[model samples]
Target: MNHEVIGGIPVLWADAPGPLEAVLMFGCGVQDETLRTLGTTHMVEHLAMSTLPRLHHEHNASVDLLTTQFTCTGRPEQVVAFLAAVCEALTALPLERIEQEAGVLAAEDGRVADPATAELLSHRYGVQGLGLAAYRGPGADRIPVEAVQEAVDRFFHRGNAVLVLTGPPPADLRLPLPDGERPDRSAALPVLRTGPSWREEDVPGPGLALHGDLDDPALQLACKLLSQRLRDTVRHRHGLSYDVGGDAVLAGPGHGERTLCLDAREGQEQRVAELLWEEALRLARECPTEDELAEEIAELREVYQDPRSTTCELGEAAGALLFGGTYQDPQTRLAVLEKVTPDEVRQAFAAALETVLLVVPCGTEVDPKLPDGRPLPRRACGTEGELPPGAKVFRPPLVDRLRSSDARRARLAVDGRGLWAREPDGTVHHVPFTEVVGVEMRGPGRVVFGRDTCVIPVVPELWAGIGPAVDAVDAAVPGQLRYPASAFRPAD
Candidate 1:
């Protein structure tokens, strides 16, 4: 493992499977102007890298609050050539173009979701101040393109940033970054704040209305666990809302604070709030014993292992290095989790859920008695909306194909393992089918595939990363079957 900083950019060149996948560049720092131009700078990157004329079959790029990553890979020197172009675009990127991009992002920021499932988002992230009220409309003045352009110009500077170039760096790979102090644009790590914030609104849905704003530091992990348990209990077992998972959102770069949210069955809307509180309380009151924690931990580890390093790991690595500002080595990172204790886990859980903000999303059948029985507000989908409403029929075969992929979504926890494919709708597919070898959950919800097993953070997004996912049945097999999100049922 050889590591060095090129042009002040941290670079890690390592030996990997033939035909390298990507050279990920992670750019993240706390800055003021960066927060402002964050959207604009990303817009510039999109225009430059995405539209490269020599692109072969596929290319992808995205920007998050923490970083913006562009991964262009192909045969031999082709990827390196593309890499040079990417660096040029990144270093000499036009501020004007970034400004334009900012406009595009502002438009996205201006979206007001008025869907039947609108309550779902509200209960999940909305009221906790984790709301997603974008002001992307033409008339919407706040968060406009100009504002973002300014921020972009002010952000993205040299710091402890890293640029990981694996496989090969073309003979000619250069960018225009003079080594020096990095400007500050992002915010600082959050200091613990006590108590919860609550809001009321009308929700439209079919089951109970559950609302909560979890303010604890463990909010992120809590979000994943609750979402998993929600799918397990509320959706699968109890049959609550059409969708029954909530979340916690740490604040954006410079504005706002972290939050938590939840929503449930329309009819049970009133009790939904109580349910969330009760669930959180129960977890705290009866914290997972070492045995219970170990079981759950095993399940989590099993989920993180990926067998092959093809399909997804490149994207993930590229994304993390580019946006997360840190390298994610599955084998090494999982080692850290193994050291966590039941006390640490339980204490973290108790601290995060106490005193949080809560929101609830409901269906058309207006619930009059919200937990506070304060009639919740109704958010409508203005005639013109981004996507069409009403439950769109999910094509099962398309989803199954993705699930059946042998590509690695993440590097395996213990090397030589991988994860299953995930669809756009956030569904986890069963890795091994009937003919193929299936992995079992050694404990709790854990699953074992091949020789490796690891705990996977069950939230759909994290589920996408099961270490490095790989499948060996070359030559595409008939992918016509469909499976449910939770297919670990008892077999007779």
Candidate 2:
């Protein structure tokens, strides 16, 4: 593939001389949105793609952790025209169909609820930044056209984008986008805990999930070897599990996580957990054999040797350029693979053990026999300072407040320094003002406090004089910290 710049946008093209597959990617997605504005990027994606005409090409739009892309597969000319239309649609977004598009987004969310994956991420990272998947979809009905417009203006521009063509570049390909600076990655959202944590959810059956940083190629190989061991022992040998695999979440440079997963039969919970640790502990203590490493390396080489490998690598290469990541071509990756010794894999596995987060079936009992697991805390972590004055405190059963039959009733006090929610039994949770990175209004009556630990929801109707108190809190926070409520609301 060759690299060039067109109309101030980076372009990567390969002369494959076949049907074309092209993608235009922007460095924006769910990570760029807030809890209140949760689906803004996605909404904008749908709105932009909605404007494209029906061409004889396969086209679609997707929003992932850190990038939103519109891709098309067809003849070179058709692909180019589709992309141009996509860019034009993005420039002048159609806000009139926002409500219609939101309905579609809400339906999409309902169809793909992989609780196992979502629970693992939420438990590991909390409901901020990349962890938004663990929570409900953004109140789509509450999103407004103005918010969608702002997202397009801020993130969809020439400087923050790239276009990749796998077959051939179209003649006179032009992208008339407005001038804008490349936007950096969004701020890191705060989590309840950064240390190793554990959570149990009521999933369909038993499973084990683990995640850690991508520090080295050896570490990546270790994850694969570990998954293989689990599958062999638990599935082939014992018939305990049907599926086991490992995946990498390479959002950008230095920011990546390897996830190891295993799904088991109904009564194999304990056995699966035991086998998972047995393999993981074994890998951490001893490196794989030369034969094993050679086999894995051969498989990696085969992937790159495929006829369609260059086309596959094109998108990843373009994404790496936009994300400040290291883009190793097939040859470079092979070179790196050769340098990875079995001993290095062992050491990487050992280090990964330090920051592991585990997710297990809620009702199942299993003991990997590691350190004692700490249950997720109810309040914020590391918050300090006395509560501010003019605070409005509200208890449960407040007007329009959603609650369960046995939900813990507490007093939520909002002040300048921060907000605190204390249980009736004197258990207190405080979110300091300094820790507040952003604030957002979810609805006309609901306010969310974006803190380092969690998103604290407060209902104004639940507290007296909430308007004045919130006004003061807004003054204490930065203007960019808040998002105005959208105009639309879902029907009952």
Highest TM-score scorer: 2
Error of 2 at 429 (Å): 4.9
lDDT of 2 at 334: 82
Candidate 1: worst-modelled 10 consecutive residues by lDDT: 134-143
lDDT score at residue 23, model 1, on the 0-100 scale = 48
Q: Runs in model 2 with CA error above 4 Å?
A: 15-18, 110-114, 185-194, 202-215, 267-270, 371-492
lDDT of 2 by residue, 318-406 (tens): 77787776677888888887789999999887777665666677656655544334342322232444334667665565343455422
Q: Give lDDT per model, in order.
A: 0.40, 0.69
Query: Candidate 2's C-alpha lDDT?
Result: 0.69
TM-score for each of the candidates = 0.53, 0.80
For model 2, the run of ten residues with the poorest summed lDDT: 373-382
